[model samples]
Target: MNVKSINILMIDDDAINLKLTEVMLKKHANVNEIIKASNGLDALGVLDKRGDIDLILLDIVMPVMNGLEFLSNVYSKNSNFNIPIVVLTTDETVKKEAMSRGANGFIAKPIAEQALIQEISKLIDLG
Candidate 1:
């Protein structure tokens, strides 16, 4: 996939995870830009400010709004923003639930760089 122009939004409460993912994605995906948010509310703010995001990597547990609630809000919102979201979590048990709630893909935490690249590439290419 030609991911050179893809802008990604990463929502996670852990600063280390966000930084690590950003670095890994930069190296592996050659992504255009990555916007980081500590929580879903902050993610929405970033979205409002920058509407060109192509994909979202979201965490399930967060302070303000969890990933599920964020997904609900995004779909329910009046805007026609149809960006694909990939749920990033440590709990593999929620994989089915996350997909059912609108996640385009799922990735367990302590993310493997290659796996993340492959998964994201598929989604971006398909979209």
Candidate 2:
């Protein structure tokens, strides 16, 4: 498949995870840009300012606002909002809840590069 570079909004409270994810994406995916947000609230702000976000990688646990809360807010604000959101978390228990809340996909944390890419490809036309 033909690869298309995309802009990703990554929302995680951990600085280390953000950096590591960025590095992994840069190395493995055709990423045009990677926007980082430390929390869901900040991610919302980023979304407000940018319209080109192709995908969202969100953590379940965060300060200010959690991934589930963010999903609620985003879907509540605009039912037609189409950006694909993939919930990234270590807690597998929240998988069903997150998916029901509007998450298009779910990935267990310590995100594998291949899995991440596959999930993105499934939600987006990367070819």
Candidate 3:
């Protein structure tokens, strides 16, 4: 499948981290759109409009509506999205929690571009 067809939603509160992630992924990874949301509530809004997203780059902790909370809402309401989710974080504890919440895969923050792509590749099979 063409990478350009997949849409990516990145949910995080930090501007610098979001910029870095966008910069890193833009280098080679092609996608239809790369949407950024500062919090889970904002992300849910995006997800509502675009339910065909192929992947989500989720951060476990945030000020308004954390990733886990987002996942729960997604699972409960967004029946259309059986989308692959890659939890991005620096915390190991949050990783465990995110996994339990239904993340397809995960990679640590200080986001490594290749590692992110690798995780996405694994989940893209479903996409």
Candidate 4:
């Protein structure tokens, strides 16, 4: 797939996670723009912005609001809610709950670059 056609929205409170993810993805993924959110609440604010985000990489635990709370708000919103969400977390229990709450899948962090790439590739039609 062409690396300029796909866009990803990544949300994490940790600066390192965000930076690592972008760097890992930049080489192969067609990244239009990466919107960074410090917490789940901040992530929600980006939905209104016009951009080419296809999938969301969401973190489970954060300071302002957690991933679950963010998912709940997302599903409840009237906006286009069909965007695929992959939960990235350090907690196994939280991953299970996130899947139950309508997450497409869960990826544990500190994310392995190869596995994360494969997972995201499967979720999005990257052509």
Candidate 5:
């Protein structure tokens, strides 16, 4: 899969998680660009500046606004935009709800290198 032109948006509250995920994405996906946001509210700000984001790796728990709220807001704000969002979380209980809300996929916490790339590839049809 040639994802050289794909830009990814990564939303998480933890700085460590953000940096680690960025490293993994750089190593595995070779993505065009990875935009990092500390929370969903900040993520919305990022979206305002960049409209070409192809995918979003989002965390469910965050300050200001959570993943589900972000999803709902983004959808409501711009109903025409259809970027794929992959939820990153530790809890298994929210899987159904997350999907129902608008997540294209899910990645468990303590993210795996292979799984991350695989999910992104599948969602964007990288292969």
Candidate 6:
């Protein structure tokens, strides 16, 4: 996959986590843009407004709406929601459920730069 640009939507309630992940992506990946959302509902709104988002990095637990709910909403509302989503979480238990729900990948929290890059690479070209 030879993508000309890559836009990522990172959904996490924790501001620190979001910032850390964004910094890591900027340093290690060939990302062009990074959009942020505090929760699933916010993410939905972002998705509605932006068609350029190529991928989503999601957190499982949140206040307004969690990652699993976000997956359900996206898949249920739009059958053609083809954007690949990678769930980022500290909990290992949700792996099976998240994958079943429609997540393309899963990365344990305190995200390792190399692992995050590899997971994103599998879903979409970082370039």
Count of backbone clashes, every candidate in sequence: 0, 0, 0, 1, 0, 0
Q: Residue 82 deviation, candidate 2, in Å? A: 0.3
Candidate 6: stretches off by over 4 Å:
1-3
The Cα local distance difference test for each model comes to: 0.86, 0.92, 0.83, 0.82, 0.89, 0.93
Candidate 4, after superposition: displacement of residue 119 in Å? 0.8
Comparing 2 and 5 by TM-score, which wins? 2
lDDT of 4: 0.82
TM-score: model 4 vs. ground truth: 0.90
Which regions in candidate 4 have their CA more than 4 angstroms from the true location?
Answer: 1-4
Cα error, candidate 6, residue 27 (Å): 1.3
Which structure is stronger by lDDT: 1 or 6? 6
Which rank order by lDDT, best down to worst?
A: 6, 2, 5, 1, 3, 4
Model 2 ranges with Cα > 4 A deviation: none
What does the lDDT read for residue 3 in candidate 4?
A: 41
lDDT of 2 by residue, 1-127 (tens): 7778899999999999999889888985578999999888999899989999999999989999999999999988888999999999999999999999999999998898889888988998877
Tens-place lDDT digits, model 1, residues 69-117: 8888887773566798999999998889888878899999889988898
Which pairs of residues collide in model 3? none
- The predicted structure with the larger TM-score, 5 or 6, is 6
State the displacement of the C-alpha of residue 71, model 4, in Å, after optimal TM-score superposition: 0.4
Model 5 Cα shift for residue 22 (angstroms): 0.8
RMSD of 6: 1.7
**Pairs of residues at least 3 apart in sequence or in different chains that clash in candidate 5:** none
Candidate 2 worst ten-residue window by lDDT: 21-30
The TM-scores, one per candidate, come to 0.90, 0.95, 0.88, 0.90, 0.92, 0.94
Give candidate 2's error at residue 96 in angstroms. 0.5
Worst 10 residues of 1 by lDDT: 73-82
